[model samples]
Target: EDKVVQSPLSLVVHEGDTVTLNCSYEVTNFRSLLWYKQEKKAPTFLFMLTSSGIEKKSGRLSSILDKKELFSILNITATQTGDSAIYLCAVVPSGSARQLTFGSGTQLTVLP
Candidate 1:
């Protein structure tokens, strides 16, 4: 079974603070690592990393994958209170099933 682990399970910070979340996974025929941000109900896709050394960014959020280390990092710069949410990391393996193995997720709280 593919397993994913996220560090610092939860975080607390004030607005404008920069934060970094980490995720590590163990799977067979790894295909990609995807990041999602969840606020209330559904999780919104953030980035999908399929190659190493390439950083994907959107606004104040960015993510990079380290295939050699079997891990990925998500960085949020100058975060706002609206950025508070649960960050999820899911690993996709190359298989006909096409399923996603998800991490427990990191809960980030940004206070005003």
Candidate 2:
């Protein structure tokens, strides 16, 4: 079965701090890895990594994939309280029905 593991299950930080979240996975016939940020409701897409060593960034958020290591990392710089949320990592298998196998996720709390 495919599996994903995220490090530091939870974190506490203040505004303007930088945080790094890690995710590793093992899947058969892997297609890609996706990152999502879940707030109070639904999860919002962050990045989709298919190629190794390619970093995707937007504003204070950035993510990179290491296909060779079967892992990925999400970095949030100069964080704000609004950045607090559950960060999820999911894997897509080739020829699957677009179902995503997600990690337990990292809960980040940014204090004021």
Give the winner by lDDT: 1
lDDT tens per residue, model 1, 1-112:
7899998799999999999999999998899999999999899999999999999999999999999999999999999999999999999989786889999999999999
Candidate 2 lDDT by residue in tens digits, 1-112: 9999998899999999999999999998899999999999899999999999989999999999999989999999999999999999999999946899999999999999
Reference-based TM-score, model 1: 0.98
| Poorly placed runs, candidate 2 (over 4 Å) | none
Per-candidate Cα lDDT values, in order, are: 0.96, 0.95
Model 1 residue 78 lDDT? 98
Give the clashing pairs for model 2: none
Reference-based TM-score of each model: 0.98, 0.97
